[model samples]
Target chain A: MSDSRVSSVIQEWASPFPGQAHTMHPVTSGQAESTGQLAQMEMMPYGQSQLMMREGGEDRVAEQMMGMSYLSYSSSCIGNAPSAASTNHHHQSHGNNEQDFSHFLLPTLRAPLTKRSLSKDSAEYRLRRERNNVAVRKSRDKARRRIQLTQQRAMQLQEENQKLQMRIGQLTQELDTLKHILSQRHMPGSEEGAAGESRI
Target chain B: MSDSRVSSVIQEWASPFPGQAHTMHPVTSGQAESTGQLAQMEMMPYGQSQLMMREGGEDRVAEQMMGMSYLSYSSSCIGNAPSAASTNHHHQSHGNNEQDFSHFLLPTLRAPLTKRSLSKDSAEYRLRRERNNVAVRKSRDKARRRIQLTQQRAMQLQEENQKLQMRIGQLTQELDTLKHILSQRHMPGSEEGAAGESRI
Candidate 1:
C-alpha cells in the first residue's frame, strides 16, 4: 500500500515537472541507448525544457528535497484517494495551457502598454518624441523653402528669356532697315550710270 | 588732228582699264608687287573687295584691258600728261578702297537678305524653318509632359503616405484595446485565485 502511494506521488510530480523527473529516472542497462538518445535531444537548440534547469538551480534542488517530504504526505492522500493523481494532472495541464496562452498574449499586449506607460512628463521619452517632431517640422519647412526658391528661380528665368527674345527681335529689325537703305543707294547709282552710258 | 581725236578716245578707255595700260608705261616691278599685294588684301575673308572680284571678274578685267590702250593714247595725246606709271598706281589704289567697302557691306547685307528671301513658299527654306519650329515645339511639349508626370507621381506618393499613416493609426488602436483586455484579465484572475484559496 505504501509503495503504491509513493508511485502515485512520483507519477503526479513527473507529469508537471517533466524536465526534472525525466532527468532523474534511473537508467537500467536495457534502457541505456534510449537514455543516451533522450540526453542528445535535450542538448538540442529546440529543447526548451532545459531552460528551467538554468533558473533557480539550487532552489529547485532544495525544493525537490522538500518535495520528498511532501511526497509522503501526498502519497498518504493518494492511497486514501485513488482519483487524486488524474485530477491533479488534469488541473496542472489546464494551468500550463493557460500560462502558455498568457505568454503568447504578453508581447502583443506589452507594445501598447509600454506606449501608454510612457510618462507624459518623463524627459527621455518626451525628448525623443520631441526630437522626432522637430526633425519632421524642420524637413517640412526646408521643403517649403525649396519650393518657394524654385518658383522664384523659374520666374527669373522666364523674365530673362523674355528680355533675350526682345533683344533678338530688335536686332532682326535693325538688320532689315540697313538692307533696305543699301538697296536704295545701289538702285540710283546703277540707273544714273546706265543712262549716262546709253547717251554716250 | 584725227590722231589727237583718236588719242582722246583711247585715253577715255584706258583711264578705266588699269591692267591694259602697260603700253603707256610698262608696269614697274614695284607697282606690280604692290598690285599683287592689293589683290592678296582683297582676297581676305571679311573684306568687300573680295566680293567685287567674285561678282565683276570679267568686267573688271575687260576694263583693265581698255585702260591700258587709253593710257598709251593719252601718252600720245599729251606728252606732258601726268606720268602714266603714277596715274596707274593712283587709280588702282582708289579702286581697291571702293571695292573693299562694297565687299564688306555686301556680305553683311546678304546674310539678312537670304533670311528675308525665305518666302513662305520656297520648299528648301520652308523645310528648314519648319524643322526648327518642330524641334522647338517638341521640346516644349516634352517639358510640359515631364512636369505633368512628376505632379502625378508626387500625388501618388502622397496618397500612399496617407494610407500608411491610417494603417499605423488603426494598428495602434487595436494594440491599445488588446492590452486593456489582457491587463483586466490578469488582475481579476489573481484576485479570484486569492479569494478561492482563502475560502479553501
Candidate 2:
C-alpha cells in the first residue's frame, strides 16, 4: 500500500513478464493444464494486484515491495487455501518470480469488501459495529477528566479573592476612627489640650 | 506565593527596622488630645506597617519606603477625610515618615481577595460556580470523543479481519475444485498417448 512498495512491485512485474514468455518450456500436459488454470485466476482483472509506483530509489522501492508482497501472499495463502494450488501454478507460469505473483495477489487481498461482504452475516460488518461502540466509550471518559481539572482551579481562585476583600474592610474601619480623632483636635481650644500637652 | 517572592520578603523583615524612635513633641492642646487618641489606636496594634530593610541598600529601600508611605497616607486621608488634620499631624509626629508607613501597608492592601468575596455575595459566587460547571461539561465532551474515536478504529480493524477471513474461505473453495480437476485428469487412460509413452 505504500507508494515505494507498489512501485517496486510494478518494476518486478514489468521486468519479468517478457522474460517469462521467452523461457516457457512445455510442462507435462496435466501440470500444464493446472498451471493454465492458475494463470487464469491470477489474470482475473478485479482480483489482480496493480502496483502504482512513485519516483524513488529502486533499491528502497524493491525492499518495500518485497515485504508487502510476502505479507500479501502469506495472507492470501492462509485466507484462500482452496486456491493455493492454482495460485502457486500461476506463480510458476509467471517464471518463478515470487515478487510478481505476490504483487499481483496483494492488492486483491487488501481491497475493500464488496456490498455482499458488508451485508448481514458477514464477519467484517459485525466487527465494525463493535469497534464503533468502543470508540464512543473512550471519548466520553477523556472529556470528563478535562472538565474536572478546570472546575477545581476556578474554585481555588474564587476563595483567594474573598480573603483579600475582608482585609481591606478592616483597614478601612481603622482609618475612619483615625480621621474622627483628627477632626476633634482641629476644633477650638478645649480641655483635651491640657491633657494632651502633659502627655507630650 | 512563589518561593522567590516569599524568600525575599522574609529577608527584608529579618533585617534591621528603619526610622527614628517615637519622640514626644510639643503641640497645641487640641492637637495633643488628638495625638493621644492616635497613640491609643496605634498601641492597639491595628496592623501597623512594619519596616523591613536589607543591608547596604539604604537609598533604594528609602526611596521605595517613601513612595509606599505616601500612598498609604494619601489613601488613609481619603478614607478619613473628616480628620485629615489629625492624621497629617500624626504622620508628621512619626518623623513624617509617611514613606515608611506606606511601604508597610502596600503589601497588605495588595493581597488578593476574590475568593472571599465570592462566598459573601451569591451573585458573584454563582458566576464563578457556573464557570466551573462549564469545565465539567467540557471534560465530559472530551471523554465522549475519545470513546467514539476508539470505537471507530476497533470497528475498522474488525471489518478488515472479517474480509481477510472471507477471502480465506474463497481460496479454500477454489483449492478444493482444483484438486478435483487434478484428480480427474490423473484417472487411468485419460490421455491415451501420454499413458502409452509412460508405459513404454
Candidate 3:
C-alpha cells in the first residue's frame, strides 16, 4: 500500500476545507447583503488592509479578519433592530429556540468564512470593512481619553483658582492689620503705644 | 480781659506754635540721621513720592501709600531680624519693658523720617522704599499664584496620563483576546467547532 505517513498528511489537508466552509455557513451571502450598515462600514478611517503585506501575501490574516467580522456581524445582527428589522423578521417568528441555534452556529460560521480566505471583490470589501471597524474603535478610544484629560485639567485649574483667591484674602487682611498698627503709632496715641511696646 | 469768646481764640492762636514746636520736638535733625536705614530705604524701587502725579498732586494717595508702607514696615521690622537686627538691637536688649517705650516712640522714629512729607530728601526716600516694598509683595503674590496654576495643570495632565494608561491596558487585553480567538480558528481541531455551533 501507499505510505501510511503520506496518507495521514492527505487526510489532514482534506478535512480542513470543509471545517472552514462550515464556519462561514451562518451569514450566507444573503444575510450580509441585507444589512444596510455593513457596506457603509467599509469606509472606516484606518486606511486599508491592503497595506498589511503579510509574508507570502498571505490570505491567512484576511481569512482571520473575515471570521472575526462575520462573527461580530451575526452577533450584531441578532441584537440590532434599527436595520435588521426587515431582514430578520422571519428569524424573529421562530422564537427563542431559533436564537439558540443562531448563537450555536457562531463558531462553525467562522470556519467556513476563513476557509474561503480573502478572495473575490465582495470578500476583499468585507475584509476592509472589518479592518476599518477595528481602526475606528481604537481611534474613538484615543479621543475618549483626550476628553477625559481636558475635563480633569479643568477641575484642577478650578482648585488652584480657589486657593489663589484665598491667599489674596489673607494678604489683604495682613496689609490692613499692618496699616492699623502703623497708624496708631503715627497718631496722637504714641504714648499708649510706647507703653504697650514696653509690655512686649 | 476781652469777652470770653475772643479771649479763647487768642489763647488758642497763642498756644498753637508751642504745640507745633512740641510736636516737632521729637525729631530734631539728629535722630533721623542716626538710623542709617531711613536714608537707605528711600532709595527703594518706587522712585520716591516725587513721581506721585494723581489729581491734586494730592499726596493723599502718596500719604496713604506712605501710611500703608510705614505700617507694613514697622510691623515687618518688629519681629524681623534681617534689617532690624542692627537698628533695633538696642530696643531688643531693653528686656521687653523699655521696648514698650521704644514701641510708643515708633511714631517718633518715623516722624523724623516722614515729617518732611516727601519734601526733604530723606522723606522722599522713605516713601519710595515703602512703595517698592508693596510692589514687590504684590509681584511675589502674582508669581505664587502663577506657580500654583502651573503645578495644578501638571497634576491634571498626570491624572489623565494614568487614566489613559489604564484604558490602554484594557484595550490591549481586548485585542489579545480577539487575536487568540482568531488564532484558534486558524489552527487545527476545528471539527469540535462545527459540532458546537450545530448544538445551538
Can you list the residue pairs that collide in candidate 1? B10-B70, B14-B67, B17-B63, B17-B64, B17-B67, B20-B68, B21-B68, B48-B103, B48-B104
The top-ranked prediction according to TM-score is: 3
Every candidate's CA RMSD: 57.9, 49.1, 47.4
**Native-referenced Cα lDDT, model 3:** 0.29
- On the 0 to 100 scale, the lDDT of residue B121 in model 1 is 28
lDDT of each: 0.29, 0.27, 0.29
The candidate with the higher TM-score, 1 or 3, is 3
lDDT of 2 by residue, A55-95 (tens): 11111000000011111121122121111111211111223
Worst 10 residues of 3 chain A by lDDT: A61-70
Cα deviation at B148, candidate 2, in Å, is 4.3
Q: What is the lDDT of residue B72 in candidate 1?
A: 25
**Candidate 2 TM-score, C-alpha based:** 0.19
- Model 3 ranges with Cα > 4 A deviation: A1-200, B1-121, B191-200
Every model's DockQ: 0.00, 0.00, 0.00
Shift of residue B120 alpha carbon in model 3, Å:
12
* Model 2 lDDT per residue over B43-152, tens place: 21122222222112111000000111111112221121111111111222323322322335555463223322322123444455445544553454443333343334
